[model samples]
Structures are given as structure tokens and as C-alpha cells.
Target: MDPRILDLFCFWLLLSSLLRLCSAISSASDHRYALGDLVPFYANKVGPFQNPSETYRYFDLPFCPPAHVTEKREDLGEILNGDRLVHAKYELNFRQDKPLQSLCKKTLSVEDVRIFRDAVRKDYYFQMYYDDLPVWGSVGEVVDSSGRVHDRRYFLYTCVHFEILYNEDRVIEIGVATNGETIDITEDKDVVVEFKYSVKWKETNKTFERRMDKYLQQSFLPQHVEIHWFSIMNSCVTVLLLTGFLTTILIRVLKNDFIKYSCDEEIADDFDESGWKYIHGDVFRFPPFKSLFCAVLGSGTQLFMLSIFIFMLAIIGVFYPYNRGALYSALVIIYVLTSGIAGYSAASFYKQMDGVYWVGNLILTGGLFCVPLFLTFCFLNTVAIGYKSTAALPFGTILMILLIWMLVTSPLLFLGGIAGRNSTADFQAPCRTNKFPREIPQLAWYRQTAPQMILAGFLPFSAIYIELYYIFASIWGHKVYTIYSILFIVFMILVISTAFVTIAFTYFQLSAEDHEWWWRSVLCGGSTGVFIFGYCFHYFFARSDMSGFMQTSFFFGYMTCVCYGFFLMLGTIGFKASLLFVRHMYQSIKCE
Candidate 1:
């Protein structure tokens, strides 16, 4: 063969090897970014990297965008901006995510340049919250790439995942990068700005836009399917057990009692009159701490209704995850609006209990729940301020919240109180109370307050205990929980469990000839929150990897208030259920 032929053959072989190498490298890179490569905890969770440019008067701390972000990482598109921002810099809203990455390394005209510069001056080095973190992404200014200067700007933006090496001192190190460009485009000839990205995610199997579809698909991974069922089934079993026991009691006891008592022939040898019949007079007596009872009921009713509406809207797909701010706003507005219900429920009940001093009652009703919540929030916010965490609310935000509380809630509550006070409805107790209080008899160990409360609470907790795990993970760990439908079911089941369990306890207390069932009924259902708080303690001690005073204070403080609210709500439900039960029992028999 001639020299030319030999050279051509060598060139062909070399080109073939180069092509194969490039192909292999590309395939490996794709596999490297697969979901499997990431830690299971982080692979499923995504957070928005927020801008931390704001400097508040009191302290320098950023505020979290999605209030439910720490609770459940739902898609916020409906509440915030759901649409992905294109190569535009106009959107700098507090709720909207910081703009990132130029489409094809965009070149802005003179007008675009001025607008972008203004945006940058306002909020440059845009911040985002992602992977349960706040990351900084810088904005770059690039001149025209073409030789002809058209008064243009060029730039790039990116996200980055960082790691801290804590020795004697904490050393911040930037790790994996998020598609940031290496080329600097600030100079002449052609200017470009490259944004940096975080490499914190262990793996990202596919480029999100790798396959674009017209229909938007929310990220609802099926990994938690098994755990979800386990939770649901566990709750179902508890309900089944409760139903079985209650059914048997209803059949065996109520049938016999109703017949003998209604006929006014209690001397029947087979029918035992050892139960609620003994407490007819005392059953109608007003309970101790009636003021607190009314308050709890009022607030509980408000919370229950608020939860229902929010969950309903969420299930209907109104509060989409991308627009998470709407959910927070909804919660704030709803909570304020519900004050009327709380006030009416509290005041009317107080009046019915033969209580006067409507002013004191009204004040206590609102203050009881709100005071603790506000205090806890303040403490947590203070901690956040010290740590420079985004959870801190600035003074302005605090003022706005306080104003909303004072302006909207205060008036509603006052009107509700007046409405309740002036109402013609009187106390409708079925049985007349004795002039003197009746003494309660000795109770069995299992029928004691503590034992009954513990037993009653366990059943209700089972309904939500599994769901709690995912909730904690979403809030404390990097997990997203958008299963609103399942949450609704669990909530209903929990309410049922609490009601039934309290009723069961009331029956036993009545059987033991103890007439102090009012507080016990509340305690019986509210004890579930004690168990929830216990689990919170356990979560902090064992399950969670959270550290630092900011996180610690925020978790424990807010959760304590949550537990308190839960206690109020569940306890109220239990009391209502037991009241109905007691009334039904007495109504069935003709009073002698």
C-alpha cells in the first residue's frame, strides 16, 4: 500500500476510538447522576434555594418562604409561582423563587440590561432554598458577544451544594456543582455570566427537562407506598377493635338497662343498677373550671373547621406545591376568621353553664390558646435570629401578624361573645342536680383517671402515629409529604378513635359511680396529644439528626404549642361525644 493509504487507515482508527471514548464518558456521566447515587433521605426531597439579602432592624436573619415547608414539602405552584421562569429578570417577588440559569446563556438588549441591572441592584446574588437549605447564586453581567456593541449584557447563574468540615473551626467547602459554567463572559468580544449550582444531591438520574411533556406531572414518588399502607392499616385495626368493643357494650348493657329503667321496674334481679343510673343528679352539675372548658371548646371548634377547609381545598388540588405561599396565607387568614366561631362556642357554653362575667370569659377564651402560641413562636424566632436561620420572622412580619390578630380576630370574637350572651337559649340539662354535690365512690385500678387516660390515648395515637413519622421527616429531615388525601383519612380516623375511646372511658367512670366525668372525658381524648408530644421528644432524642439551638428551640417550642392545641381540640371532641352519650343514656329511661 502507498504512504497515503496507510495514513488514511490510521486516521480512521483514531477517530473511531475518540468517538467511542466520548460516548462511554457521556453514558457514565448520565448514570452517575441517577437517583440511586444519592442518599435515600435526600434523593426524594427538593428545596428552594432562597435569597438571604434582607437585613432586618432587630437582627440579620432570613425568613422561610413556605410555612408548611418544615411541616410538609407540598408542591407550592398554586400558592406561589408554579410556572418555570424563562430568561427574564422581572420577577423578584418575595414568594417567587430566585431566577437561575440563562436560557442558552442569554444576551440582553439595552432595555433588558437596564431592567436586569435594576433587579440585580435590588437583589443580586439571589438566594434559594433547596435540600432544606439556603444557597446563594450570583448574577453576572456580560457584554455583547458580537463585535458590534449594541449596549447589551450577557450573564450566567447556577446553584451549588456545600459541605462543612468541622474541626477546631468550621471550614466551608463547596462540593458538587449545579451545571455552573466555567467560562467567564464579563469581558469584551462576547460576555457571559455563569451561575453556580450545588452538588449536594447525591444523584439526579435525569435532567428534569430531559423529557418535556405538555401535561405537568408533580413529583409524587411511590417509594412511600408501603409505609403509607402500614400506617392506614394500623389505624383501621385500631378502629375495628374499638368498634367491636363498643358494639358489644351497646348490645349487652344498653338493651337491658333501657328496658328495665324505661319501664320504671329497676327491681329486676338480672339487671344490675351499678352504672350511670346512680349519677343522674350529678351528671347535670356544671363541671369545675368551666371557663377553661368553654375556651378549649371554642378554640377547638375553630381549629377543627379550619383544618377541614384547608384539607378540603388541598385535596381539591387548589393549594398546589409550587404556590406554597398561598397555603400559609390561607392558614393565617382562616385562623383569624375562625375567631368568631371560637368566641361564640366559648361564650355560649360559658353562659349555659350558669357562668357570668362574660368579659373575663371572653378574654380567657382567646388568650388561653393564643398566648402560648405567640410566646413559643417568639422564643423560636429569637433563637432563629441568633443562628441566622431563615425561620426567623422580621419585626415587620411580626407587626403584620399582630395587626391581623388584633384587627380581625378581636372584633369577631367580641361580636360572637355579645351574640352568645344575649341569646335566649337556656341550659337544657335533662336531670336536675342536687343542692349539695354527691360524693364519688372508690374506683378500680383500671378505671382510675391515669390508667384510663393512657389506655384511651394509645388507640387514637395509633391512627396518626405512622403518619407522624413522615411528617417529622418532611419537617426535620429532607422528605416531602404531599399525601393530603391520606392525611384527611387519618384525621377522620383519629377523631373517631378519640371520640370512641373517651366515650368508653366515660362509661367505665359512670359504672364506677364516679360523677366527675367532665374533666376526665377531656383528659381521655387529649391524652393522645401527650403521646404525640412524647413522640416529639423521642424524635428529637433519637430519630432526628437536627442540631443547634435554633433548630432545637424551633422544634420543641412550636411543637409544644401544637401539642397544647391538639389537646384542646381532641379533648373538646371527646367531651362533646361523651355529653351526647350521657344524654342519650338518660333520655332512654323514664325518670322516676
Candidate 2:
């Protein structure tokens, strides 16, 4: 084995062990504190309750500040997730209960009142952490006593109550109660606002290892579980039916076609020159814009592998809701590492197609996905900056990502392209192509690419539509998605459905004497993304309470990129499956 390969394998092992150790340490009661030892309380972020993605710095609001504030160091993932933990003024001692204590008192000016009123009206909430356990509290609330929209009162919660549950010396859980003092912020006058907090330590039998169990079940309601199971069963049924139907039809059709065309050489000349056999020469012809198709397929392959690895990690409990920033961090790192796969796949396919511009193919492969992603990121980042939201990527973080791409991703991609160009075999079609191009007969309305693509995409889209709803809720709402096992199952069903549907469509197109199945198969398979994007619209309008320009733009903008990713991933799967189907069908028929 190459030393570099061995070193890479060792590094992977080390990384896996570190992740496992971190997960174990996070849940274990390894950190013990004596009585009177200071327990640092860190304020995280504040955001509108309706929009989880819209978050701002804890101190963004005109709140009382500490004498000298310090920030808790965070990893790349945490920063990317907009987690800015800062030292809070609330003082707490482990195992030491404190009576109601004044944190800070300040006279709220008109501007402060306006800020508080707006926050209260928007139902803004704040988050904090103690002993790595999270706690949430609302900034204020709007009470409509008169049952009229215009007759509303905005009240700010001035006092916060913290209850810390501990097992022995380790903190098991932290809860925040906001039913303390409240003051009306409806008035614009200067008001003396006093922030107070009380800490009470309670003993619990719950072990430290089970400390995160509550959070795991925080959003896993009975109804949600039922819905998830229902979706999975529904998807499985669809896949079984669709697969059985496609298998039976394709087998019967291909069997007859094979027997008819496989007549002994003496009788083969009498057969009619029609059906898919008529287009054998054109079926394997390189599609137009070969570089783009290859690049999309390559990127799709990379995304396909990336999704599988991430979901597998999730299924094995490497990623959980409590592990802040870990999932996104892993996604970034894994994607960067997998850039070489995209390069290899794209370059090899292009080379096999007798492409000469290997360098251009490599560049297209790298940029096909990243270019759109970068543009979307820039748009979203601009909106975040305009709204003063923490979702905006910091300049340093952006620079770091670019550096990773430049230093690691780009080189690996180039090396993979080189290896692929050197090692890949030439295109070997079972049937030789004629010098003149074959004219495709006029296709019927139903046989046209548009209708075929729509029909092809709907089955795969239906298979995962229910699950998409839950996923959207989990991502955009407060619901936590912990059912990775079911998600994985649905994902597999989706892939199978896409492949079968694409192959069936390709067969139909070929039978119609349209040998342009290359791009058609890819488009048909990826059309599921179009349906998904359409569903995003329905979700935005019918399902969610998300409004305003920022949230709306952010939702649709990111969703476009997500749907595009689905397009590439599923399209690649379809194209590969169709390619094999075409090769086997043509090869077995004893084409002339």
C-alpha cells in the first residue's frame, strides 16, 4: 500500500475515534464540580420564534451588558451555525442554591422600548447554555385581551428562573421558567427595567449518560412518529408496486424483442427494421454538451455518496440534536474530501467519450455544483447582513472555506482527473455508429420528453413527499428530526424508484425511435427535483407561517440549491442505470 493511502486510512480511524470519544464525553458525567465552584453561563442567540434560521447575537438587543464580556471559543461548525456563546453576567455556583438576585438594572430609553416592543410582537426567544445543556426563554409576549388585532399589549419578561438538575456533581439538565416579573413595554417612555434571576439545584436519579435523552425526545411527539412510520410504509408500498410493474413489463417486452431479433443468421434478415433495434447505432452516441452532462453526473455521484455517509453517521448516533454544529461541520469536511470523487467520475466519463479537453472537464466538474452554491450563499449572506442576522457567514469563515477548497479540494480534484484520464478505457459501443446521424421520428405528445420527464419524476417524488414535509419542519421549525433510520429507508426507496422509472422511460423513448436517452434519462430522473421545488412553493404558502422578504428569500433560495442537488444526484443514478440497461439490451440482442 502507498504510504499516503496508509496515512489517510490512519487519519480516518483517528477522526472516527475522536468523534466517538466526543459523543461519549458529551453524554457522560466526566466533568464534576465541587460546591461553590463557578459554573459559567453563556448566552447563545436570539431569534424570532416563528423562524428558526433567523438568529441574532445575544447582545444585539439593548440588554444590560457585563463589566467585561468574553466570548467562549467555538469550532468551525459552531461558527457556521451562528452560535456565538458569550459570557453572561448571571453568576451561579454548583450545588449552591441562590435566592432571588438582581442581575442588572437599567433605565430603558425610547429606542430600547421600541426594540423590546418589536421583539415582543414578533415572539422573539433567547437561548443560553449551562454545563452544555441548552435552555430557552421568550423575550416577551403580546397579549390580546380584547380579542382584536389592534387592541394588544406587549409585555417583556424581566425575571428569569433557572432550575438546574444534577446527578451527583454533574449537571443532568437545565430548565428555564419565564413566569417571573413582567413589565409592559407598550409605552415609549423611559422605564426602569430590572433583570433578576434565581438558581435552584435539584437532585435527580437520571444518570449523566441519559442527560440528553430529554432533548432527543423534545420534538419527537407521538403524532410525528406515527406520521413518519406512515410515510415509510407508504413509500415502501409504492416502491414494491412500481418495481414489480416495471420489472414485469420490461422483462416481457425485452424477452419477445430478444427472441424476435435473435433468430438464426439465416432468418434474421426477414425481421422488420423497427423498434429500439432500429436505433442501436445512435443510442450510445455522445450527448450534446458532453462536458456539462459529465460534470453534473460527477457532482451527483459526489452528492450521492456524501448523503449516504452523512445519513449512515446519523443512523449510528454520531450526529444528534444535542451535538451542536457537528452535523454541518461533518457535511463541509466530507464534501471537501469527496471533491476528488466528482473529479474522477467526471473526467473518466468524459475521457471514455473521447473528450479532448480534460482540463475544461475537470474545471466544469468542480464548478458545476459549487458555482450555484456560491451564488446562493452570496445572496443569502447579503440578506443576513442586511437583516443583521447571525446566519450571515463571517468574512473569516468565508475565507477559511475558500482556503480549504483551494488547498485541499482543488488539488485532489486535479489529481483524480489525472488518474481518471490515464486509467479510463475508450467508449466501446456494442454497435458501431454510422458516419451520418440518424433522424429521430416525430414523437407523440405523450412520448415527448416533457411529458415523459413529468411522469418519470412523479413516482419518485411521491415516494418521499411525506418525509419531505417532516424534513422541512425539522429544518425550518423547532421540530428536531431524530428518525434517521426511517429517513435512510425512504432514501433507498427513492433511489430505487428513480432508477426503475428512468430505465422504463429510457426504454420507451428508445422504442419510439428516439435514441437521445442520455440526457433524457438524466432529466427524467432529476425532474423529481422540479417537483420538489414546486412543493417548496406549496410548503411556503400553505404549511408555514414564514413571511417577510428575508425569510422568504432565504427559504426559496436555499431550497433551489437543494432541489438542484437532488436533480444531479438522482439524474446520475438514472443515467447509470439506463446506461447499463441499454448496454445489456443491445449486447444480448445480437445487434448487427
- Taking all chains together, each candidate's TM-score versus the true structure is 0.68, 0.95
- lDDT of the candidates, in the order given: 0.62, 0.87
- Estimate, for each residue in 58-99, the C-alpha lDDT of model 2 and write its tens digit: 998988778887998877778888898899988878988888
Model 2 worst lDDT run, 10 consecutive residues? 21-30
Please give, for residues 1-592, the per-residue lDDT of candidate 1 as tens digits.
Answer: 8744553454354345333332312112221122222311111111121222122211011211222222223222211221111121222221123234232333434444453453333333443332222233334434456766555544433333343211111111212333344333233333333333222212223333222111122223476777888889899999999988888778888887777666535465456655678778788888888888888888888888888877876786554433324555556666776788888898899999888877888888889889998888777677657745445665766775676566567777878888887873888877888889888877678888899989999989978988898777755544555678988999999999999999988988887789888899989989998999999989888886555455567678878888988898999999999999989888777654
Best by lDDT: 2
Best by TM-score: 2
